[model samples]
Target chain A: MDTILFLFSLFVLALFLGVELITKVPPTLHTPLMAGANAISGITIVGAILAAGADTSSTLVHALGFIAVTMATLNVVGGYLVTNRMLAMFKRKS
Target chain B: MNITIVNLAYLLAAVLFILGIKGLTRPKTAVRGNMLSATGMLIAVVVTLLDRSILTYDFIVAGLVVGGVIGAVMALKVKMTAMPQMVALLNGSGGGASLGLAAASYLQSLERADFGTGAIAVLAVFFVAVTVIIGAVTLTGSLVAFAKLQEIIPGKPLGFAGMRYLNGVLFLASLAGLAMLIANPGNTPLFWLTVAVAAVLGLTLVLPIGGADMPVVIALLNSYSGIAAAAAGFIMGNTVLIIAGSLVGTSGLILTKIMCVAMNRSLTNVLFGVMGEVG
Candidate 1:
């Protein structure tokens, strides 16, 4: 319970910090930043990889983990590449 | 690697992630910002692999290769006009990944009978159930949003005569499923049933929303995905996941709020207003 509380505290603090940081973004870059931020959401891939490789897990767990990894990879890889693409367009225009 | 070292690496990665987001305040550094975040992700993944708990790599290697290739192809091929659609798709996959992880984690805990005692055990079950619900909702909601944006479905509001009542019922069912899972303690929990209900709920909830409101919907789902990941982090007791997930969670919320302002609608209206009739 203490651990949960600690983690929860971290979650809340990070959330506030995120709001503070993101508000600084100008409206012009909203879409690109949104894409970039979505890519960061792919951080779930960490959980997916851990689940996929757990020694005590069953075949079902492994299978689910496999799919999770694939999905998360798409989020990270597809997300970042496309975000970069969008940002590049902005750069070219400026 | 030592536990301390692994955790330290995770901390460094989290710092990089924060820096990455901070960089987005200006366009001059935005692209580099994304690269920094990606680099942080690479560090996290590589370090996670070195943890001694994993015994084999076949599934990991195969999944990375396949997912990586497909992701690259889609990213490269998609037109800029289709960027929003691509973002929606990728965001959905992130949610799907969280759902899968939560399910797997729940099952693994059951197999090991590792649910601890007292507040910890109760909290564990709570987090797991919430993670599944939120994750499933994000995945399907984003998909429906994607379909609408891509013109795979009509972009206009599409709701049945009794959608409100049905949505109410489904929402209640989701709550009931959650309550049952938390109350039962053990033995064949209704995980899949809960998943199905939430899935349908996502489909129904987003269908009534018009295409013009998609930015709000996508932003909201992106927030959901991040929260799901954070809840999953609770299940695993991983601090890094918790931090990163919450960062995305709130970041997405800000984006949603900004979109709402741009559309001149309150969040509630965007979420549950009377379709084209509301605005």
Candidate 2:
């Protein structure tokens, strides 16, 4: 219950913070911003690792956990690398 | 070993993630922002491993290696023009992970006979159902978005007669399934059925959206994946997952709104206007 309440507060705060953070960004940077945000969503990789590593006797859990870990890792690695690539192009030539 | 220390580390990781996003507001710091967030992820992963003793590390290691290789290759080889589709694909994989995690949790609960009786059980079942529905929808919707963006499918609204009505009906049925699952948390059949229906609903929802709407759709799906992860966090009682999920969810929503503004469309219109058609 306390956790849920805390999480709700966090959600509201993050929403406002996100809006504040991105409002100043130029339209041209939106693509890279979107890409960067996609990488952030890969935070689920943490949850996936927990799932895969959870102590359990069920083979089904193990299988699902393995698959989740793989997919989430892909999201994390691919998302960050791709965002970096896009940002590289966006950087002004020195 | 120490739960308190583990949680404290998670808190630190969450703070780093926030700083990472803050850094992204400027172009100069964006790359560093990405690295900071990745470091946060690394910290979270390592801390989780330290907190738990696994029966086997084989699957986890194998998954990391395989997924890492594929992701690196895709990131390196994909063209800038194709970045949108690649992002969509990555978003879909996140959704896929959520779906798998939610299912695994449900299975674990069943195995352990942990479906406590009464209101608590109902809440547990509700969270699991929400995770599965959103996760499944995100997975398929993202794939459809990718297909449209990639030209694998026509980049136009694809709808038939009564399509909207069919979608409404399926959505209602899924809601009814949720009600049933809550009433009886042990109903595995109902749970799977709801998942199947939700997957179909996801496909139907995105199929009618055109290529021009891919960015918004992808952003929206990214938010769905985050919400799904948050629900999974509730099921697992993990504070970091909750914080990270909310961050992603809120950020994705903001991005979707930005996309809508850039396109000069409202969220409702982007979702329901069925581009390339009059209505």
Candidate 3:
């Protein structure tokens, strides 16, 4: 319970920091920001790694982990590359 | 090789993630910011790989290679105009990953026989349900959003007259399933039922939203993807996941608000009302 509470508090603190960090993004970059942030959402890849590599006999667990890792890798790699591409487009014009 | 060092690395990774998001505030630095975030993710992944609990490497390496190759191809080839749908697809996958992680973790816990009947059990089950439902919703919801944006399906509002009530029933049913799983902890079927209902609720919720409202919906789903990650972190007792996940969660919410204001769309209206129907 202490751990959950501690984590909850951390989540709340990060919430404030999240708002503080992204205050002045140009509207043109909103999509890019969304894209970049979406890539960060691929942080779930850490969880996926844990599940995929967990030493268990259950095929279901392995299958779910494999799918999670695959999907999250797509999310992470595709997301960052796309964001970079979009940002480059905006950068070239200016 | 010790746990403390691993945790310290995670802390450093979390800090990098924060700075990475901070970099997104400016156009000049946005690309660099994205790279920094990626570096942070690299750090996290490296640290996770070092953890003692993980024994098998075959599936992990294989999934990474396959996913990485396909993601690279899609990123290189997709037109800029299609970026939104692309982001939607990625966001959905992230959500799917979290939901998958939650389900797998639950099964692992069952195998370990560690889901005790104490308060810890209650909390663990709560996290599982949260991860499952939120992750499932974000998964299917983002997919529907992608379909609408990609023109694979009609972009118009897809709600029926009873759509609102159906959404309500589905939500309640998911909750009941959660309750049953909590009480009987061993009822895997009930647990799966909860997953299915939550997934259907995702489709139902996003169906009524038209293409015009997609920005808000996408932003909201992005937030949910982060939230699902954070919930998974709670289950795993991992700080880096919590911090990074909530960072995305908050950033996504900020983007959603910014989008609402920019599009001159009321957040609540687009978010709650059936889009094509004007009351």
Candidate 4:
């Protein structure tokens, strides 16, 4: 199969799956869910790492890559930690 | 070190990401889900570094350490009341990363004379252009949304005469720039011009959105960043990126829809109404 065509199919499947996954989440959890999803968006860190480390010869590319890596790491680390903090408050009393 | 092994690792990471989102559906599993997703990210980063034989580990290590510390401190210290703003800023950072990656890729390609004049090259340029525009827009737009939510900028709708008309013009200009980019992939000047216009478009589009609509705006921008990353993945032929990006895009869109519904406003109204101030 063509790679792009396969990617589009995967994209459509993920779309439906995403809606199905979150449809039942209550409003009270919306903030934490959003935070959690924000953390997931930090998946760009993968791309950033590749870009930053792919070529060390070009200073400009290196700078861009380094910045990307730093910003993405911040997103991933901060996002997860904050989501965990928020979810901690939602726990039921023992 | 084998290519197939790296691909398999990426595939595994993608599955972990999906499971992470699924876990978030329930409060009891939300924290675990977050961890699952973070683990997935770690796996992906490590695999990319080892598989690609990246020559510069020092910069990457420095970025991770500094960024991790800052993120941890912010997460630990931020108030719940500021959670929305924090999410907005995090989303912005992801968008910033996408923009940075796209820019780096473009510059590197230019240096290597990789932008060959072929159908495939045009298609690759199209994806890169999409990445640049969407990534830039998401970065600035999310920042504006963050400022509004943070109350650093006024939360009231800031409209000027014929703002909608101006936005329309800017949107059309970006499309024109995109067409130019596809026609000639080596046109770096045109590419940066398009990105700059898109950045302004993002600012104008979000400036008039009031504070009440910030949550929806943030969610929508989150989707934008995901779509931008997906475009970057297309350019790089990275399957895991495409999968993870689409997952975030779809989930963010769903969340935006839910927020709109919760606010009793349609998506169109939230975006175009610009009348969110309630006495």
Question: What is candidate 1's lDDT per residue for B131-250, written digit by digit as tens?
Answer: 888888889989998998899998888887678678788878988888887776473548788888988888888888878888788888888888888888888888888888889899
Q: Each prediction's DockQ? A: 0.79, 0.65, 0.83, 0.70
Residue pairs that clash (backbone atoms under 3 angstroms), model 3: none
Writing each residue's lDDT as its tens digit, candidate 1 over A1-94 gives: 6777889898899889878877766676777777888888888888888888887648898898899989999899998899889888889988
For candidate 4, write residues A2-91 as lDDT tens digits. 776777687677667666766777777788888888887788888888888886488888888889899999999999898888888887
TM-score of chain A of each: 0.91, 0.85, 0.94, 0.87
Number of clashes in every candidate structure? 0, 0, 0, 0
Candidate 3 per-residue lDDT over residues B107-137, each given as its tens digit: 9999998886698898899889989999999
The lDDT leader among the candidates is 3
TM-score order of candidates, best first?
A: 3, 1, 4, 2
- DockQ of prediction 4: 0.70
Least accurate 10 contiguous residues by lDDT in model 1 chain B: B270-279
In candidate 4, which residue pairs get closer than 3 Å at backbone N, Cα or C atoms, i.e. clash?
none
lDDT of each: 0.84, 0.81, 0.88, 0.83
Name the candidate, 1 or 4, with the larger DockQ value.
1
TM-score for each model:
0.95, 0.93, 0.96, 0.94
Over A2-26, each residue of candidate 3 has an lDDT whose tens digit, in order, gives 7778988998998888878878778
* Candidate 4 residue-wise lDDT at B168: 82
